[model samples]
Target: MDRPHSTSAPRVRRSRAEQKRETRDALTVAALVAFTRDGYHGASLEGIANEAGFSKGAVYSNFGGKAELFLAVMDYNLGALRGADWDPLAMPEASGSGAPEPSAGHDEDPARMVRGFGLAMLEFIATAARDDTLIHSLRARVQVLIDAYGRVAAAGRPDDEELPVDEVAQLMAALEQGATMLALSGAASIDSALLRTGLRRLVTPAAAANEPSPVRDAHASPLPDVERVRRLIRDTIDS
Candidate 1:
């Protein structure tokens, strides 16, 4: 019993760099929430710092200013989406591989989070359009996504196929941005499943796209039965 002595673990300390990184991350999360609530024009560094449980100086020290902070938030959110854990971009695993199966949201009400961030992002993009420097930064960040998409497109196509990466990326980006905005704006008909199908078809090889879809359902068709309509028209004409 005399040999039994309780010892406490030594206190571990974070280096200045580690502490700084932690502060930046906390600030980013708080800024994400604040930006979503107030947007880029309405939000303030002071409010974000307070939300993050830090002084306004922390935001200034970690980020140049609001523009920088917003970019950081964009990177964090968009990067997470691009990661292997999620496929928000509707990127196919292979060129013609079947559409990725839909999965449940990772968190409670994930759609809310998506809409919130999407709103803030679109607002900032609109605002940035008027600012050259800010737009440049935004373009650079967006280019990263486009580049990744180009790589994927190139991968899916045969080496002989003339897949203009830039063109392909531009089309995919346009579709993705437009589709996301529609979905976030409460388009009941626009969901991930449809988005996946649209994106999958967009990059599918010309030869494969002409072939009847291997999977068919109510969602697959976007219009009335044209063949049936044509047959009825012919019958009516004959009659």
Candidate 2:
């Protein structure tokens, strides 16, 4: 009689750092989804931990507090959207009035950049509309944007005598937030049109003059509309 040998292979083990990163990423994704749905005030660390399949201590260890967690979520979401492939500097040139001359050594086309910005805004609004936690998190992000933009405008090129970057950022954030609120409240008509118009106006004052109305013409072909906008956003974020 002959004996058979076992054929099973040894399993590979993950390094501690790799395991930690995996756990951290899972927590961030869970938090993003949970916060978007529950809102910052409503979401609990325990709930996030449960969702992530981690313990409460894990959540606390990774993020000091709810605010830090919320900020991390924002960074996660925004970082997903930024990169050289979608470089702000490569956008289409603006052909309208009040367009800021491209800063020296900065050659991105303003028109395309504005369109991309509009798309990014619409995506954020859409996400917020679907998730209460995201909405709350975004409000905090808006405040940060205002403060950061204010400081930049005050310090860099103060003599430009333009609409303060902080003011523009706040206005954009408000419009996007308000539009999302309206959409969520059954106002489907309140889409990215307002944001597109505002951004265009902000980026190219001359273009604003050419078109008395910022809204794309009512009779104009829809151009695949909302889904197209969403796709662009997904591409930006996922890129």
Candidate 3:
């Protein structure tokens, strides 16, 4: 009877919920790196799983499919973008006369903020340019911008005021994609100089004034399909 003492210790109950959450986090991180490197079409669930040290079935179980995974990647990247290092000019306080000085904890500088945004955007575009899956995701983002601008125009804003939103969004997207491609191809420096210059020019009062107005009537010409065409061309070329 003494020799029959139980050999096994009591088992701790595993938290299935916690395990699932950790799995989802791993898959999302892996998808981000893979999509950034491989493009949306080029990246696969299997690849993401491998990157995350999980099985492909794990990815499928957690994310459903490529589209859902892509959305996850987008959310992850945007989150990072929003957390970028500070810039003073873009900070609300910087635009005001009574703005407080940069405290030891606060890094407020608008130019720096714009530059940070430019750099993050460039890095994202460069990564997407190399991956098929990511390209599709980027195309989706472009469509979103177009749709957003269309809505702004439809909301009865003055034609002149509304037009620049779409135009500026298009220009920013193009510059970002183009610059990323060029930088990746080793054709230009990846710094924000060119982007900053372009942004300044695009936002100039004269340039804004000169932009084509959104149509004012119900029968107004459809928003030019230029952004769609541009995205298609860029995707095709990158592919």
Task: Name the best candidate (by TM-score).
Answer: 1
Error of 3 at 21 (Å): 3.7
Q: lDDT for every model?
A: 0.67, 0.55, 0.54
- Where in model 3 is the C-alpha error above 4 Å? 1-19, 35-44, 82-139, 143-162, 205-239
What digit string (tens of lDDT, one per residue) describes model 2 on residues 1-239?
Answer: 87997799888899999998888899987877676556666678999999999899998888887756766766665545332232211222333597454343332222233333334445555666687766887677656645543443344323444776767656645655555445444444343444555544544456544765545445221221233334345446559
Cα misplacement distance, residue 190 of candidate 3 (Å): 5.9
The residue-by-residue lDDT of candidate 3 on 93-161, one tens digit each, is 222477443343223222233333334445566767788876887877656544443343334334354
| TM-score for each predicted model, relative to the true structure | 0.73, 0.51, 0.46
lDDT of 2 at 52: 95
Ranking by lDDT: 1, 2, 3
Q: Find the candidate with the highest lDDT and give its number.
A: 1
lDDT of 1 by residue, 26-140 (tens): 9998998888778777889999999999999999999999989999998986565555443333422332356343344322234445556667787888978999889999999
lDDT of 1: 0.67
Better of 2 and 3 by TM-score: 2
